[model samples]
Each structure stands twice: as C-alpha cells, then as structure tokens.
Target: MAFPMQAGPGENGVDLPSTARMHDYWLGGSHHTEGDRAFADHLAMVGPLIPYLVRTQRALLRRIVRYLLGQGVRQFVDIGSGLPTCGQVHEVAEGSDPPARVLYVDNDPEVAADGEDLLAGNDNAAFLALDFREPDRVLSDPAATRLLDPQQPVALLALAALQMIPDSDDPAGVVAGYLRAMCPGSYLALTHSGPDPQLAYACEMFDQMKFGPRHALYLRDPVAVQLFFTGLELVPPGIVPLPLWHPDPERDPTLQNPGQVPVHVGVGRKPGFVD
Candidate 1:
C-alpha cells in the first residue's frame, strides 16, 4: 500500500508532519506547523519523557560543540541539522573566544529556508539542503568547501539524526564515508535513540506514528551505535548515555540522573595529524 502523499511548503497535497519541524517544536522553536505540533503532542502522550530526552540531547550537543572549540576545531559540518532553534551550532561555536564556521545541512526544504533566515547576517554560517546519507554531496558542496578549511580539523555533528536513517540506507557506510573525507583530527559527535528497556514501549508507539515510514525511528543497541565510529578513536567515557558522556554539572543541574535521558552519545576523532 502506498503512503498518502506528503507535502511541504508550496506543495499542493496535504501537509505532512516533518521530523525536523516536530523536533523544533520539542525544543520550543517557532518554526513548526500545526500538524507538527499535533504530532509532537501525540508523541508526548505515548512517550511522556520524550521531550525531556530531546532537551537532554540538545544540551549534550552544546557541550560537545564547546568541547570541540576547546580542542581548536573551528569548522563544523552539521549534517541533518534540523530547524535552527535556540543554542544552535553557530550560536554555540561562534560564542567561543575564536568563532567557528559551520555548514548546516538538512534534507527538508522548510528547514533549509528557516536555517537560511536564522543565519542571514552570520558570515560564519551557511545552510544547505542535502540528505545527510549522501556524504559525498555534503562534503563536495561548494559552500561547505568555501567556508571550511580542508587542512584544518573539523567537527561533524550527527546528533539524534542517525536514528532516522534506516538500515537500508547504509548508515554505517555513510558515516565511514564522511570520516574518510574529513581531515585527520576531525571529530564526529553523535547521539541516537537506543533500545533501552525503559524506552522499549516508545519504539512501538513511534512505529504507529503517521509521519510516514521513511521518518520512522530505528533504535540501535550500544554495540551498533559504537560501530558507527569503527576506525576513529572514541573520546573518553565512550558511547554512554547522553548525560553520562562528560556531563557538565554547571551547564545542566540534571546530571543527577543521567539515565533519565534514554539515549546514547559519543565523540570520535579521525586519527592522525591536526593543525
């Protein structure tokens, strides 16, 4: 059976719920549509703790970006970068002593549009519409190359977005391809929903969602998540729950219960020279 036609801005068919938009709503962003809000509300009903988990993931992204900046990484390629909400990559990176340059990539046109508007005056940031599964497309984009120095270390953010890349898309290969293209000393900070016992029931709920099969969530175990960083050297406290991966008490007082997030995160560095 064919899924109902889904439409985005300017499309005539019924407006479909977008994962990016729904995620924006979860993060208290203003870019989501009514349909996105409805879906988010439904998600809350089924997985009451989902919003909190989302918040935790977002906070973790901030911490990771800060850590990358401290490591002297000033270029970032944010694949699957969703709607530009508060505390976005550029905001976090550029806020550092030496600002960082970032390329925000997302497949959703609406998200691309919003990102463009949000990054309008920031010369350090650029938004491009590209499916993250196509690592070559992301790396080869003219804008990405223009803004980021290939010889310098870079940070590739794959947070919370990999779970949406179904197994058939060769998620592992896609990640490896990105790592291969990045210069040595580049870092990949990734987070994903996992098959935690506490959230097993949420998986079933997500399966029943009407957002279309392509947007369905694919939960992986810790081993599978770690596989994405195969050749790269994982940072300390490797592949642990979101809060447990270098949780900063100053940034988030909720570190008291790292397990409450119900997701896994890790940072891996492409091995070799970095300048």
Candidate 2:
C-alpha cells in the first residue's frame, strides 16, 4: 500500500500535484497544469466558496508581518514560501522601520526555481529547497544562515502550508521543533484551513478534494490549530477565525459573512526573548 511516486509535478516525471499550483489556480492565476486545474475546480464546486477563504488567509499573513515589523523584528524565515506572491514578506520588511532579511524555504524544486527566477539579481533575499517537516535540515542549511542571522530576532511563516503534512508526519511536533530552533525573540506567523459544519457535507458534492484520500487536510477546530502555537505568547486578539483577527475593519465589505469564507489564524512569540 504505497502511494504512487508523487513528483513535484512540472519538475519531473514523478507525477505529483503541488500546494503551490493548487493555490495558483485558486487565485485565478494561470501557472497551474491540467492536474492543478482539475483539483481546484473540484474543491470550489464542493464548497463553492473556498477561493475567497483562501485569499483571506493571504491577507492574514500580510497583517502578521506588519505587526511583527512593528515589534522590531529584522529577519524572517518564510518556510513554505511557494510561487511568486504580490507584496510578500520582503516587501513588507522594506516597508518597515529597519529592513528585514528573509529566507524562503520549500521542498518543491519547481517552487524554489520559480522563486529564484522572480527574485533574480536581487540582494537581501534567498530561497532554499527545504521542507518544514524537516526543521533540523531547514535550520542548518548554509543558505539559511547566509541570508539570516538566527541569533537576531526573526519571524517564521507557515501560512496555509501546515495542512499538507499528513497525520503521520507529526505536524504538531514539527511545529514545536521549529520553535525550539528559533531564537527566543523569534515569531511565528500562520494561517490554516478549518472545517465549518454548514459547508455542504455531501461526498458526491466534493469534486477534487485533491489530496484525494490522503493528499490534503484541514485543522477542523480552533484548539487543534492553536496547538501549533504551543509555548508561545499570542499577540493581542489571539487565535481566531481569520477575518476576525485585527483585520482592516474597513477591509472588504464582503468579509461580513463568516460562512462564505472560513479560516483560523494567529501570531505568537517564543516567550523568554527580548527586542
């Protein structure tokens, strides 16, 4: 009972779908392959409101970085950094008082390749082929140290990526391992998909559910999502449904409906750290 060899899709013949491609399709972007399209369309048809929920999660990440910069953080390790994003971590850093250095990590070679191409000829930035599940490898990579000084206060971003790890990978432990490896002053910026009871329960209604029988998952509850932030001090407003966590208030008027868009997000600091 082995899963078919899933490659990083566009990068080789191993034949696998990527979180990045699925996201691209969700954002109405065209970089996805036929496989990506099929999955996205299926998920949308099932819930009929997943894309908007997906974008709100991105908004949550933006809010977290702006808050982190306000706290004097000057370095970032954006694990799960996938395809080129608009006004991402580096952009948010530059918009702050003292610029921050950032390291982007991902296991998909195609994602790492695309990231490198997007940041072509730029300094103050670097991307590595690393997976969040392997925190030790991510923390020890030469490139990680090259672009950032861990001793300095830093922020780690998991944003919408943790669910990709299967239950067997020990997702909670993986999160704890990263926190221990980060300097005390480090921060974690995050978001994740969660289940809502009224969102259509018909199996027949589900089109892609792409992770298929084992490819994807959702946190399902606030407690499960909050457990990932264990041993950290939550920033004011704490972990709550995405749109409710310090949003623009004037953000998009469309965000008023909780059911149409669902997500859980938060920002936490490793206690026992200083500015």
Candidate 3:
C-alpha cells in the first residue's frame, strides 16, 4: 500500500531513475529528483534518438486523447501516468466538451501526492497508487473505483508502461482481464515501445542504469503488440504506427510525430452492452 506525499529512496535503490521519474524528468516536470535526470541524461548518451522518441510518444498521447474525447469518451483510467505536465490527458480532456472524469494510476507516492495537491479541487479527477502490472489491486483502489464507473464507457490508457512486463507477467493478459471485467463500450488506449533498429544498440547502455535494461521487454513486433487488443474491435484505421494513426495534417510533423517513432498506438472497443 502506497500513500501520497511520501518521499524516499525506493527498495530497488535511492533516487535512481525508475520509469516514473525518468518520464517525469523527460516531460519537464518538477517532481523528479536529480538522480532521475542523471539516468535520463545517461540514456541520452546512448543515442540522440532517445529524447526525440520520448517527445514523439508524448505527442501521440496528446493526439490520442483529443481523438478519444471527440469520440464521446467521458471517463478515463490512465495507468502508469507519470507526474503532471502541460498537454497531459486531464488538460486535454477538460479542454473539450462533456468533461472527462479521469483516474490517474501510478505507484509513485510523490506523483500521487503532487496530483492530490494540485488536482484536489477537481471533482472529476483523483490519483491512486497503482502498478499497471497489478490490475487486480489497482482496480480495487478507491480512487479508481469511485471516479470510474464500469457501467459507463471508460478509456483505459496505458502508454510506455507495458514494456515493463515480461512473459512471466503478461501485460496483454492484464489488459484483457481489465476489459473482460468492464462493461462493454469501454475503450483501451495504449502506446508501447517497440524495437526500432535505431534503438537496438542503446539497449546495452540502459542495462546498467538504476532500472536495468534487462527488466524491459521492448522488442514486441507489431503483430505481438496487436495481441493486447485481441477481443476488442479496433477503431477504423485499426492498429498502426503512431505517425499514421489519425494524423492532423495541420500540425507540423516534427511536433506531431517526432524522431524515430518506436511506439504502436491504438484504440479498441469492447463489444457488448452498457448495462
């Protein structure tokens, strides 16, 4: 059980770059400590492409959120959602009509604390300590249950986090289980890292970091990644590289789809009834 506002070195190590803070640092957020930046900077040493890839992934997220909102989704459960930043889901969701009720799920206490402090007044928002790998426990979290109504259409958004799970813990199965338990009409929006050839050589360098590269399963092919949405009906245009998925021609390619795009994104709907 994690609590909000607590800060310390984690059991794995202190102040090192875990996925949450690394992402926190990349997104130009303040919650990340120096150690987090150190690791992220180290990753930059691996290749210039890493940072560009990170930023593009974020842009894809922004595009996806707007698209989902346009499609009438009013509820969202964002797993592995890192620290706060501009152009984030909440900002995009509320910026549109039919305001979204969002539940942010991340195991980091500091992120939760910051969210609680910053987003407390929001009637439609709350944050909970949730590990994406542990769906059972996450679904049980009060913040998740209270804000998200399973009977209604809820967007299950997991981006850049699924790679943390190896075969021993099936992220796809986790997604399937979550969808199985939710009422039909629920949507799953996901973006996961894939092995772009350019990123391959950087793998060894990441291994020595605070969170070893060995812990990551980043080589999922497009076909393998598609398994995550097995039972659901993919929105028209189906699963595709992030760049080609609902592109807005008005936006510059650099900002719209930057660097070597290594993530695969899609929105799938669980077919059934709303009851």
Candidate 4:
C-alpha cells in the first residue's frame, strides 16, 4: 500500500520533512521520503538510543492495544495517529474475539488522506482529518460519533503524540475534555518523552533541527505527564519509563535496562459506571 508522499499541490510538500514519516522511517517502515530518513539519521547520531526508544514506544502501543482487548474494549480513538505503518490500532484491536472499531485522528493532510485510503474497504475503521487539541470537535466529529459509542468503553490512545502539544496549547485541558466525554470504563493509554539529563546534547541537536512549531518536540517531566491522566486511575507501575510499563517478557525482552529509554508510558482507567 504505497501512499502519496505529497498529498497534493502545497499539501505535505516534499520540501518539508514530516514528523510522522520520520517516525515510520525510524521503525523501518517504507512510507517515508529521503528527507524524513535524513532527519531520523540525524537524531540517531545525536541520541544513539532514540531509534531504540522509538521501537520501545511501538512495542508499548501494541501491548496497550492487546491489554485493552483483553479488557473487552471494542472501540478506539487514536488521536495524532501518524501514517499507518505496521501494528496499527485497527489491526491489533480487530484481531481480538470480536472485531473493534477504530477512528484515527491526525491534522496532517497527508496522513488523513493516506489513512482514509488505507482503510477504504474496512467498514469498522476510519480516519479523520482533525486536530486533537480541539477535543469538542474531535468528540463531535461525524466520523468519530458514527463509529464509536461515547456511552461505551473506548480506548483513547495518545501515544507518542502528546509531546507535539506544547504547554501553551493547554494539553492537559484537552485530555480532560476527552475523559469527560468518555464513559466510566473507558481507558486512556498515553506515552510521552520525559526530560532527561542524558539527552541534553540530543535536545540541543533537536533545537537546531528547527522543524515547524507543530513538529517541535516538548519533553515533559513525570509530574506534567501524569497530569494528563489526572482524573483516571493508573493501571500499574504508574508513569514509569516505556520499558517498565507492564513489561511483557515476550513483546519486550529487554526490560532489564531501565534507563535505556527516555520515554514514559502509562495506561489509566476513567473511574465511573461501566456499560
């Protein structure tokens, strides 16, 4: 499924690198351009552990989906879902006993266009071209309302995406808005890069990259990251490094190295009545 790298004239122009595409490239996916690869390679040079960190993030998403499936969650809203690569939410969630419904959201024109095309024949899944910051719009969007029942438990995934939402955007409020609209048993699985002293040089390098403000990275402390899960109850290992979150021996065999990854991951449940 080869998607257009450049969605249209001036939309996702080949001149600019896409953060989503770079992520795909880091995960060894084929949906990225040379510019994306170059950026990823630069990151790897600055922070040799970044590629491994990304892989860890990917493993966590898979684990979270499987865990949600085990809990009988059949609907998902993956906000800021980048380009559809391997182990997408739909594939993992639908693989359960009863297939799941997924609505992927992204403001990137290229991602939305390609995502809709990717799920063309899949009735249970869809993609929306919307920003996650506007929780009201996202919750009320026709596609999301049509596919997901707000009265039921829907797994909301903010994986690796929240970092793109800077402090001025009031990301915490955005998360709370989603939680308020969700039913009691609904779950929120999120992962964000944590501030690390070891990554100072990498951070410097990232600052130099001078990507668009939308693509700029924001590394938040545990306290700030935990705020996103404010009203929810953490599952376990509360806001630990990505490798420590429900460390699945099979999926992730290298949990022994706790400090290997600088990303933080967690899953929390919204307290209330369950349907």
Q: TM-score for every candidate vs. truth?
A: 0.88, 0.82, 0.84, 0.89
Candidate 1 residue-wise lDDT, 1-275, digit = tens:
00111243223212666666776777788877898788667767767777777777778888898888988899998887876676788887766767789998877776688788888988888999888888898888998888988888888898877877779998989888887887999999888877666466765656676534433567887899989998899999999988887788888865778767667888999999855
Write the residue-wise lDDT of candidate 3 on 1-275 in tens digits: 00011132233333455555666566676766787777667767865676666666677778888888876788888887765464668987877676788888777666667667768788888887666667778877787778777778878988766765676787788887677667788899887766676666666545554334334344677788789988899986887777777776676264454335776778899887765
- In model 1, where is the ten-residue run with the lowest total lDDT? 1-10
Task: Score candidate 4 by TM-score against the native.
Answer: 0.89
What are the lDDT figures for the candidates, one per model? 0.77, 0.68, 0.69, 0.77
Each candidate's number of clashing pairs is 0, 3, 0, 0
Q: Cα-based RMSD of the predictions, in order?
A: 3.9, 4.3, 4.5, 4.0
lDDT of 4 by residue, 1-275 (tens): 11112232225554566667767887788887888787667666766776677677778788889888888899998988887677788877766767899988888877677778889999899888887888899989888888988778988899877777678998888888888888999999988877776566666666687532233567888888888888899998799987788778976865768786777888999987784
On a 0 to 100 scale, what is the lDDT of residue 132 in model 2? 67
Instruction: Give candidate 3 regions above 4 Å deviation.
Output: 1-14, 207-214, 255-259, 273-275
lDDT per residue, candidate 2, 1-275, as tens digits? Answer: 00111243244421445557667666566667887676556655665656676666666666777878888888888877776655568866776655678888877788778778877776777888776688888878887777777677878888767766667888878888778777888888777666655343523345244335333344446788888888888987887777777777665344577555556777889888464
